[model samples]
Structures are given as C-alpha cells and as structure tokens.
Target chain A: GSYTTSSQQPSKLLFRQLFEKESATYTYLLADASHPEKLALLVDPVDKTVDRDLALVKDLGLKLIYAINTHVHADHVTGTGLIKTKVPGVKSIISKASDAKADLVVEPGDKICFGDLFLEVRATPGHTLGCVTYVTGDGPSQPQPRMAFTGDALLIRGCGRTDFQGGSSQQLYKSVHSQIFTLPKDTLVYPAHDYKGFTVSTVGEEMLFNARLTKDEEAFKNIMANLNLSYPKMMDVAVPANMVCGLQEVESKPC
Target chain B: GSYTTSSQQPSKLLFRQLFEKESATYTYLLADASHPEKLALLVDPVDKTVDRDLALVKDLGLKLIYAINTHVHADHVTGTGLIKTKVPGVKSIISKASDAKADLVVEPGDKICFGDLFLEVRATPGHTLGCVTYVTGDGPSQPQPRMAFTGDALLIRGCGRTDFQGGSSQQLYKSVHSQIFTLPKDTLVYPAHDYKGFTVSTVGEEMLFNARLTKDEEAFKNIMANLNLSYPKMMDVAVPANMVCGLQEVESKPC
Candidate 1:
C-alpha cells in the first residue's frame, strides 16, 4: 500500500496497493469507512508478504471482512490460506468451480455489498477454468465500474497461458471479448502479474495492444501451441504446495 | 555419436548420440567391442530420455558403463544418478569438489581410460563450485585433445552465471583466459546448454565473438549484473530438487 493520506469524507473510500517483490504480484486492500464496521477486502495477496498488508489494514483500523483469490495462480504461491490462519473470522471467497475450500463460492452476477461500494463477480475463465474478475463500483453514482481485478485472465500486454489446467484458447477468447472487452473502455484493468512494464492499464489499452487477446481464435491457438514447449518448472512443487493454500507442513520425523 | 551404421571390425569403435527434446540436452555413448568385457562411457545424459540412448547402445551390443555429469546443470536436470541406478555396475563421475556421491571424482590432468578413448578432466569452476570440462581426443591417432565439454562455463556466444553458488566473476575471467582460452584456437567447444541456434563453436570463434567472455572483466561483470535481474524462477525449488538428483515425490502422487 503506497497511500500517504486518508480521506475525511464519510462516503469516500480508499484502496491501498501492495506488491510482492519476488513474483511482482499486486495485492490490493479496498476499504470504506462509510460502512458501519469499517469493513475491508483483500484481493489476490501473496504468501509471506501478508505482514505488510496486515500492517496497512491495522493502520487504517479496518476489519478484514473478506479475503478473495481471483484464481489459483500458476506463477506464484497464493496467500489465501495464510491469511485465513491470521484473520480467522474473515470470509474466504472464490469461484464455485475452484477445488479449494471457500466460505463463499461466488459466481457471475453475484453482488457482494460492502457499504458504499459493491463487488460484482464476473466469471472470466480463460486463464484457468475457475478464474474470475471482481468489478468494483458504486452503482449509478459511479455508473460504470471503473476497476476490475483480472487475476491471470488478462495481463496488460498478454493473456494468460491456455495450456494449464482447464485453460482453453476458445474459452479465453470468448471471455475476453464478451465479458472483459465489453466493459467500459475507460475501466481500469488490474492484473495478477505484470512481467513487462506498467502495473495497470485501461480496458481500451489492452483491447488495442494485447497481442494474443486481440487475435482471432485460430491465431490465438497457434500462439498458445507454440508456447507449449516450456512447462512451468515450478509446477511439480507449486501445485502440491498450493493445494492446501500454502500451509507450511510439519515434517514427519522420528518422535 | 550420430552414426548410422555399425560394423564388425576389431580395430573400430562405435558411438551413439541422443538428444532430449525438452532441454535440448545431448548424451553420448562411446564403445569399443574389441574389449567386450569392458563397459561403455555415457556423457552428459538427461533424465527420462534414456530409452533412446539405451536402444542405440543395444544396437551396438555394448554394455552399459560409467556415467558422467559435465557439471551440475541449471537449465536441465541431469540423469547421471538415474543411469547409475538402472545400470547396476555403472559408476558415476563428477568433479571432486561437487560434494555429491560418486564412485570417482577427478581433477584437471586426471585421465579416465576407457579402451580406445582417454577423457582428461579439466577443473572449470567458474560456472559452479565443482564445474569441470572433459577434454577428450581420438586416443593414439589424435594425441592432443580436440574436443572440450564446457558445461555452462562457456556457451556458444555467452558464458554461465557467476552469481550462483561458489561462482566468482574474477574466477570466471581467470578460468576463461588462463585455462580454456589457452587451448588451441581450433579446439571444438561443446557447451552443455544452447537455447540459441548454435550447438558448438571453436575456441577461436568464442574468443573472438562471445559477447561476455570476449570483453574485459569489468564490462563482463556489468552485463552479468544486469542479466542477473531475471533470476531463475525455479532457483528456490530446482536447486534443492537437483541436489537429490531429479527425483520428484509428486511422481508417486496423482496429478
């Protein structure tokens, strides 16, 4: 979170941005004081970098109301389970299709209300079968949802790999075109990872510049097929490690 | 070892070459049937791709012999341990400083005699602490060695990382200039990994054109420092996994 000042107005909201150095993962904490309990939401946090996020949450004196994962990340270990351990009372949310345990299994069109702001779950499963994007807005007042948390579904310049578990080039094409690209052009697109420059971009920017997503299904498939040569080197270890949501295992040893 | 035909001649020796598709790793087998009781030597093999190499060896009716790793690899897993496991009597050889379990550990000037061929171990630790290059010649015909298996220490157009364990930029500079560069300019340099177009180069070719090794030590260090920013994403898991030599517990578990 790089926030330097706070808003005094009761109706206004604040969002703190955080980065995980190793994977360059971005985690955001959205807070609204207008809510009765000073509730907050954490999005796509990384494992082991929670202390800093928690400190920001504490400094703002907001109760962690919900912890959500846009999808199970292929690039870095997830911190959902770690956050669950620390903030026991907070509800854990994910897409209903995800295999991981979640307190609230959300789906498309599902609205999660948090005071003056609301998060609308949009099933955008191109990157992975269970991936989703959370559109945050204030309804008519903010007529268009100006922000989206696009997990790994859509990066600034590249779409996620379609060769991983439950990934489909066709599905990804449709998701990007119908659900994401249809969003307001000015809508801010925040992704899970950005290997290249710039942390965020507008929906219009990605539609115009994202090489893979803008291509037709056949062209997209060709690109994906060529990328099949290199499998994730960490897949063998990461998948199993992430299965239990990054819980540090107690070694089995001689008692 | 890309020979196509085998002949029955008391004076002749046979060899076979196998390439692993994933990492483009090459393994070579050299054998002389005049000494039927003696086994052949396997060099720089890759894991899980032994069937092809085994078939070639069987075609020549040669017994499985010794296994050697030019160096501990960073890009691909090595199959020295697996080969030793499958071939009961086969001994594994690596640099003495490698600290892994091997039947024989050799240093520079140490000769490994296998029938008609003599492999001379040359300590080339710039790549990693125990990195070694094997200087081999056509025994009596070519009294002087002409081929060098420079594992990552020297690539076709570049060199290995000095930021890894026991790696020193200064040591690499000395090793290249004082040891490898001192070799005959026409000596063949076969590097362990080549993602680019080249598979091999002459000592003179590398000395004249290699961007890093050809430059001054300070300039080389600056390039290395910048390249180091893109750290191997698999470093945390790969090193520990490779230490035990390519055995993954997940192989036994369901995907």
Candidate 2:
C-alpha cells in the first residue's frame, strides 16, 4: 500500500504528553526521532503553558511545524496563535466545521503527516460539533498500537459532558461507538483533558469501564440531564478568544 | 545471550503511567502483553491513591506480584502496604539501607523481573541515603532504551533536596555520575515525582539540564545548602508511617 523505504523511516517516534493543571488540559508533542530536521507538531496546547512547551521543544532541538487543536475549547484558549507568532513558519490547524480561524482547515480522513508518521483524522462530534480524533496507523508492522487523541469525546473512565457546545448525548454515544470503540483493543486513548490524574487508557479498558458510554443511550441521556455541572468559568472568554485562533487576545494585551 | 525462544516471548510489554495530583507523584504499572498469566508490578504508588490504583490494576486484569517503593518518601506515604492488604501474596520492596520495613529488601545489581522484562536496580543515594534507581535493559535487541525509575534522586530539570534523612550533596553527586549518568544517553528517565507538568525525560537531557546534578560538586553543595526549603509538612507523619510500611497508620484510624 506504501512505497517508503526503510532508510527513509525514522528509528523512533518522539511522543510526550504534557498537562496544564489549571484547566486540566492535556497537550501532546509529537516528532520523528533520529531525523536531522527533527520536525515536530503539537496538539491541544493551552495558552498558559506556551513558554514551558516552547522551552521543551527548544531543549529537544525539535522544529515546530504545526500546532493543531481538536476543537475550540471552552476550558482554555489555545496556544497555536502564540506558537505561530513565536515560530516563524508554524501553521495553525483546526477542523473546518468548527468555523474557527486557522491557517489550514482539515476535514475527516485527512492525513496529518510528519515525516513517516501520520495521524488520521476522524470526525467525532457531540462534545463539540467540530471535534475530531487523531488516530495513528495500525498494523503488524507498526511500532505501537494506534493511539486515539480523543479530545473531549472520551476520557479515562469518563466522557466529556454533552450539555453544551452543541452537545448531544445521543450523538456523542453514536460517534464514540462508531469512530473510536472500533479501534483495536490495545489502542491507547489519550484525551484532551483530565480532572482525575489518569494519564492514559486503552480502547479495550474504556469499552468495558467507561461509565456513561457503557450504559444504554436513554440512561446516558438521563445521566447527562442530571450532571448539574456549572457553566465553565473560562467559557465566556476562552470560546471567543479561541475562535479567532487564540493569539489575537494575547497580542491585544499591552503586556 | 538469551536462550528464550520466539514463542515464549510476549507480543508486547504492557506499560501504563498513572499520576497522583496532590503530591505530583507518578505511579507506574508494567506487565507483559498478551500473557495469559498477566503478572504485573507497580512502582512508587501513593497512600492517598491506593483505591484508584487498585481499581486500575483490576480493570487491566493484571496480577499484582510486587508493589515496589524506590525509597521511603518524606512528602507522602507509600501505598505498598494497603496494596498488600487488598491483594494477597503481593511483596513490598525497598532498599535494605532505607531502614524502613518492607517484605523484600534489594541491593545494587538486583533484578526485579516479571515475565521477560526486568528492572536492574542501581543504588543511587544522594537525595536520601537509601535511594535506588531502577533501570531497564538496553541493547540492539531491546524494544526501547533503558528506563531509569529515579525516585527522588532526579526529577525533570531538578534533583531532590539533600537537607534531611542522611542527605549529602557530595555523596549524591558521586552516586548520580557514577551510576545514573553512566547509562546510555537515550535511556528514558521516569522519576518518582515531579512538581512541573513533565512526566519523563532522558538521561542525556538531564545530564545537560538537571539544575542540581549538572553543577560541579562544590557548586551543587552550595545550592543544596542555600535551598531554604521549608520542612515538609507531611514528613513527621509520612516518614513514621512509611517506616512500618504505610498500612498501619490507616488501620489505626476508624469510621
């Protein structure tokens, strides 16, 4: 199916999962290992932790190529805009359906490639209509099982609230069952955020243990109705700031 | 040379990194993938998170053979005893010199094995006199570079204080350079705890960037001396509770 040669492939893939405690967001840094260029990309970076992420990138000698967000977050403004401002050629990417401003807009099935490694995008809405999951390739030849970057659609033993942001409990259930649960049992699940300290989970584990997802749709809807979660504190400012690429607000400040 | 045949080898090694937010401690779960027996081990679990960690181990269908502590911690009590209370035949491990009671005592060059994977214990005693670093094997045939579980001896861009519990800056410097730093440059470093959001680093990165360990012996001693760090709030309770293995304190309390 592919024509790439062995020498052209990287010996390893550099992966790091970083946390932003205030919003409990998880940001991901991915790059190809042993390549001279050290091309890298980030997913779901938060505005508050740009400095720390940038320093890490510099320390690893990785070249920034893209800053991608799975959705426009209500919890925190994204750092893509700040990253672009700091790194001359970096591009910001978001799902076109989100109606957010980004340098490049992607749709489902699009391949986000960094050297030989690529994340296949899958549209998994209901947490937010534009939500997408980035999945790695899987096969006997792949170094590791597929990893699902399930923004807010999935969490460890939990799922994102479908009470706001065009959220529909029914739609979320459908999306997860169709797009994510079908992955290989061992596929690692990395979410966009976590309130609990869990860092990762597997598709098999979640299929068996995910609280709301395991219930029937009606029960899940009932649970969602009664969740009684207060409106997110950052939603008012973060949503607007995030829609325009998360940089203008930071730049708008005199500092 | 390994006499083990291909049929006996596991398809993959199951690894999970769990976090405890209160203390910023990271607990590790490791097992051989696809083995019917599913024997597993945990490293550096915290007292506050025994329930959460136990639930996960059960969810993963892993048999807990050992609950190993890299050292008796001052900031928080270890969870080995509570784990033992819940799971039968689980051994609690610590360094023999730590002066804390554990079911099994380890010395340098000790091999802690589960299935085909094993961690080579190397005594690295600078943060505390009894501190040890557990390193995985590395070579052309290994799946990944060695992983050093450097319990407080090293953290990301920092090292533990040498202000108490047989602390010595010069001794720490000697232990690190002679034991940990001598490992392969690419060996991944997994510390017992981290204040910052970083979860892992490499021996090479820490060698160049570790704030305390990178300094010359004299300079390192000066930094450790002037830290002015406050006495650990939980030291009085945690240290004593940890000495007899962490479960007795919990048993002493009632509903």
Using lDDT as the measure, the top candidate is 2
For model 2 chain B, give the 10-residue run with minimal summed lDDT. B1-10
Candidate 1 differs from the real structure by a C-alpha RMSD in angstroms, to one decimal, of 22.3
lDDT by residue for model 1 over B118-187, one digit each (tens)? 6788888877888888876544433222567787788877888888867877777778787788787656
Off by over 4 Å in 1: A1-11, A141-145, A247-255, B1-255
**B-chain TM-score, every candidate?**
0.82, 0.91
lDDT of 1 by residue, A74-106 (tens): 767767767877887877777876665566778
lDDT of 1 at B32: 48
Each model's lDDT comes to 0.67, 0.81
Model 2: per-residue lDDT, tens digit, B139-186? 432335557899988888998899998988888889889998998777
Write out the backbone clash pairs for model 1. none
Model 2 residue A236 CA deviation (Å) reads: 0.4
Best by TM-score: 2
Q: How many backbone clashes does candidate 2 have?
A: 1
